[model samples]
Target chain A: MRRDRSIIKNEKSLRTYITPPADLYETPDAYILYIDLPGVTKENLNIKVVDNSLIVQGKFELSLPKDSDTMFSELAKGEYRREFVLAGDVDRNKIDAKLVNGVLILTLGKKEESKEIEIKIE
Target chain B: MTLVRWSPLRDLATEIFDLQREINKMFDRFFRGFEEEEEVRISTWSPRVDISETDDEYIVRAEIPGVSKDDVKVTIRDNVLTISGEKKQEKETKNENFHRIERVYGSFTRSFTLPGAVKVDKVEAKFKDGVLTIKLPKVEEAKTKEIEVKVG
Candidate 1:
């Protein structure tokens, strides 16, 4: 291995994954999670629910012209991972997910037993 | 008062303490996203960016997910390149019960002076997949030139 290649390997070892920013909201019907995942195509994303937690992971490679030379680079291109513990009332089977413009939106529905029941005066 | 002698061990302990605090702060930022705005002069949620130089143009890319195309604006004036945008929250606070509010929503502006003269008219900006790419074509004189030297 060459010297510069070793340096690149060291940099890769320093960071194996990034935790993308996420917005989590709860409504009467469900808990919604919106995560930023730029440069990731829809097919490249992987989402799973296990151990009472919601996990989202995606892999992305930066697309740049072959002739271009990076002068200043702050963005990291690699695997993105985020895990959120699901609430006790959430129904994993009712969860729905969608990808819009590189944003992963996950809706975890609340179980019927968890919703509040309104009472009216007779 | 008598001068106190320096303690190297104590200094090392303090240094490690400071490093631990810094690492904790970075983890907080990574998991929780942006902090609440406290200052009006500058915002803390600026998007990360990358710039590359091609033969004819400079490619500038920024990661700004969840922002609409209409909300973002790009402009070049007085040799300064500016990219500004707002990521608005559409939550109906009255109806929804939020378990958490970690996503940042507010106006953000980033600007920088161009290192070399570029064709303002030829500049192109594209926003897709939550990433903004700006291509600034360099002027003919600003492009790199190479001269070959005869072998000795």
Candidate 2:
């Protein structure tokens, strides 16, 4: 029966989607993002890149028994949506998305010209 | 003003209380700036859970993303249901440069006292997509019953 302030705040926004927590990492050639979306499956997940922004949306429904009453609740139900602004050097066409263990992994590859290359002197 | 006698014991108690308050304030100030970093180092986070009940059974669901099924454990004792698990971070990211990190990783435990007796042997649990669902069937005596009456 532990009550967290963030859970109570999320309950107030039940009608809207929750902003899932995320992590961002930068490698030599790509930027990777991981978003936690528990209970979301591949079928209900949507990812798209529009302009320079990457939008991610996922919906999950918990099916309960008929005529059931919720005794205690802290888990957020409904949709999850998050958007990130892509950098200018990111190659939109090379972006990849994967859903693994309820986490959405997005890899935004850098453009060919943006990647660092060793210069040779004669 | 009436003259009051000063007791050494009371004076010592007051001094100790003042010292305790000052120490607490100092610790608060010291930890306030590094709360996030401290959380990352400790890595203990509780997963959100939902519990529901119907006429015959109770259902519990917990959101534990990035945790493997083998890492989770469920148990019931003394009418208390407990779910515990550890969420491991990806190994490859250990040395990577992280631009931002908001997701939590570590062990967590949550327990709830059951409202009614349940058939402990009939409990079923399933894990999928990082959500753990538990179904606990209530005992025969604990099931709710509805009655209908005829109108005259």
Candidate 3:
């Protein structure tokens, strides 16, 4: 356990079994990443891309009483945070993000020159 | 002769308190209406467990899926069995996106007081496919045995 500035300098990956499955697909033009994120509203979600990295942040409101006795509670009350680094061939300006059914689907289009890669043996 | 004016602070506090109470009531109704409420997240998620008693030993099984074996810790001290663990989040791409997050994370601990005398020195624990099984063998005298009676 090592720390700097009272903050965890190195955070291990935060994996959750409840996270929606992600599907990656690539065509000649672009690549698509689909992730499921239920119980989240668009108003409470934020998506940002900075310096070749994409960040997704959203708070899950349990909306439960603090003192009330709960029969069962499965939905965790906290902000969901996830980040990903972009590849060199990714066209950041053309990236698109959409939230539907509590799932975040991101489409990263490839650069024009990289769309049709060529390999030749001299 | 001076006149004292009433402030709205008290009225505001009362209004806030009433709002809080109303919110609580609404949440109570919503929770009651939940059909498939399974496990609630408190400080940690502790699932219900079942224990079986046999002639040789006591078998305990706990339902804790998505939790790794390395995260679970089991110990017995003075006839008190304590199980504790923390489920660490998994690794993802630098820009991992999630749609629905429902899993519970954090440290969970459960303690059980042994009902019958048993051999603590030989307590064994095995974690397989998300289920933790513990076997506590009963001492020779603590085990129920059949006695033969020879009479005319």
Candidate 4:
């Protein structure tokens, strides 16, 4: 019986959450961050940047009608909250956020003073 | 969909996937409202709410599905209103293939700090259609009243 219980415990721990993949890339003008968040909606998401910290939050709603019963449940439902410390080069004022499909795209441009500019002489 | 040995459409598929993810995030944020990290939990989606004033009392509504009245716990502490509850999972399934499972379970705790004094003893909560509604009637002194205006 003890051996059987151990196997059940192992199986429960083996069931893990699939971490969504994200990518952060830099361009000449901006740093772009792409996050993959499947089975999510625009109505339950939030993004905020305070000083050097960037916080992203999202909730997945899973309510069914009154006479509904579940045959199976695989998708996990809860709030998604993640935070990141911003690099000094990121321009807090010029950051842009856009959501399409189930992914979140954030573009943080360089500070205004750091942009490359060419001098013109008449 | 057939895959060709050399197809530029592969890149198009990746772009479409990216766009879908972005749109999903936008919609999620619009409905979540403001939340603090302390509200974290394994499951249970608690929505942010705005409480309004009325002539008699204040109205508060919370979205808590799959939870019965007996599973919920309401308490008032230090002028903060707290609601905590659990939604137990249904009976186990023996054999079934699920394409999608999206309902949230487990427990959740949500608190709101009142701006004015509340008659805690008189507070009431009602659950209907997966929504939890609370009424916090104000005390006699806490009630808002219009005063006569005098020219300065």
Candidate 5:
């Protein structure tokens, strides 16, 4: 029921961009996002923030032997795309991204003024 | 209108019938080389795989992200190739407040029957970048041969 769009198709490339499964976690200092992108290398992954939206794109290469015929195919090869709208508290400049074991981990730090502050009473 | 009383035995029989139908549907999907999308979120999820056949060998590649190389197991028994593994969740995320969770975790197993005989001793499997590729060399008799005819 989330408002994010799932899949997008490129007209020129004729390649479909699937939305990879993701998990979002909120901590006191940052928001962490995990995206599963199997068979995608770090060089094939792209992440950028435009305005208040964070967009991620990845491509998976399927290498087959010469003169080979595919008998059964269930794995989707091509591209993966997903976009998330940033909240006001999220500091876009403090975002960190890393690829580990084919999973993309993104940490979006919270803004200075948005973090919880403890006040002492005299 | 006639009121019918609920019977426990009848209800049990209907439940068993539904279970049998579900199993049959699962087998049908397996033979068709397809899986339902909604099933990915279940506790036990199967990774997507691609099978290709060359002139000398059969290649199988499976997509299993976030799984360690040591957690995977590949075996060919009775001409059935099976790939089983576990995708463990990160322990650091346990304390964090989760907003949305769509990725699947836990153990998975996928099996496929080989169409031809292969050299089990020469099979090789490699895991890289969360994808496992297995190569099964075909036996001599199973390899395709080219024959030419000479006109008299």
Candidate 6:
């Protein structure tokens, strides 16, 4: 997959949120990040990698009906932002991402120099 | 063999974030009363819901994303409607290195008491795009009736 090289500038000025839940997992060759961004469409998500941190942000647009009444309000509707610090073991060029059903999945491939090599005895 | 309770999500990294959010929520609630609505709005960890009533039906909408259809259940018995289900974690990965866990995962139940008798057979429920919509049709007597007044 082609890498996302266009950096999103001046987006940090907007008010951010800390609610969307995230999970990270690592494999032998890569690390995966899953972010729950419900109600956010693919067009509203922004994924960026700067220096040593990977940032994922999403915006949600939900409007209630004019005649509706909110009996219960729990889920906060706003931007969902999360950042992960890459520890130099990740391959910046090989990173990839996809959003399915409002869940953003980011995979950061491990650097070839960081993978463990099994030694063989003659 | 004896076992020790282990939870990686309970580590210090997540606790600090949770603490910060608590502080922010407190401040929001403190200033919320200044609005025109005198009643304070409370936010919880559960899914948000909206309930509306029309002449023929009462509609309920809930925002519960990322949950599959099989995991959710809706039932009504004795005029008490209940939506209960489990929010399970994503399937196991090769080796998960969790950083933050903000989404709640567990079995949750939200029940609502119907104000008037509804036609149980006519109730219809639909789940789409992680939102659940339930339509409860009101009985004949439960609907409002308009009467004209004679002029003096």
On lDDT, the candidate that comes out on top is 5
Candidate 4: how many backbone clashes? 29
Local distance difference test values of all predictions, in order: 0.80, 0.83, 0.63, 0.63, 0.85, 0.71
A15 Cα displacement, candidate 5 (Å): 6.7
| lDDT ranking of the models | 5, 2, 1, 6, 3, 4
Off by over 4 Å in 4: A1-122, B1-44, B47-50, B93-96
TM, every model? 0.74, 0.75, 0.40, 0.40, 0.78, 0.66
Docking category for candidate 5?
medium
* lDDT per residue as tens, model 1, A11-103: 956866888888778877788888889877788898998777788889877778899977657897779988788899999899898887668
Of candidates 5 and 1, the better by DockQ: 5
Q: How much is the lDDT of residue A118 in candidate 2?
A: 83
DockQ ranking, best first: 5, 2, 1, 6, 3, 4
- DockQ of predictions, in order shown: 0.35, 0.41, 0.03, 0.01, 0.56, 0.21
lDDT of 6 by residue, B26-128 (tens): 8657544211121222323356676767777778777777677788888888777777776767756334456555666666667666777899999999775
Model 4 Cα lDDT, one tens digit per residue, A1-122: 98997798589556444444455666657777655554356666788986578877776665443443232233445666656688788889888887654556788899878776778998
Candidate scoring better on TM-score of 4 and 5: 5
Query: Whose DockQ is greatest here?
Result: 5
lDDT, candidate 4, B29-105, per-residue tens: 64343222343334455543445456566666555544667887878787777778886544233333222234455
Tens-place lDDT digits, model 5, residues A36-56: 998889899999997789999
List runs of model 6 lying over 4 Å from the truth: A1-18, A120-122, B1-46, B52-57, B93-97, B119-124, B137-140, B144-151
The candidate 1 chain A region of ten consecutive residues with least summed lDDT is A8-17
Cα lDDT for residue B86, candidate 3: 77
lDDT of 3 by residue, B1-152 (tens): 78768779987998999999797777757644222222223336674455556676766656454466778888877666777787544434355443334555567777666656779889899875445678889889877789999897
**TM-score of candidate 4 against the unseen true structure:** 0.40
* Residue A90's lDDT in candidate 5: 98
Off by over 4 Å in 5: A1-15, A119-122, B1-43, B91-96, B149-152
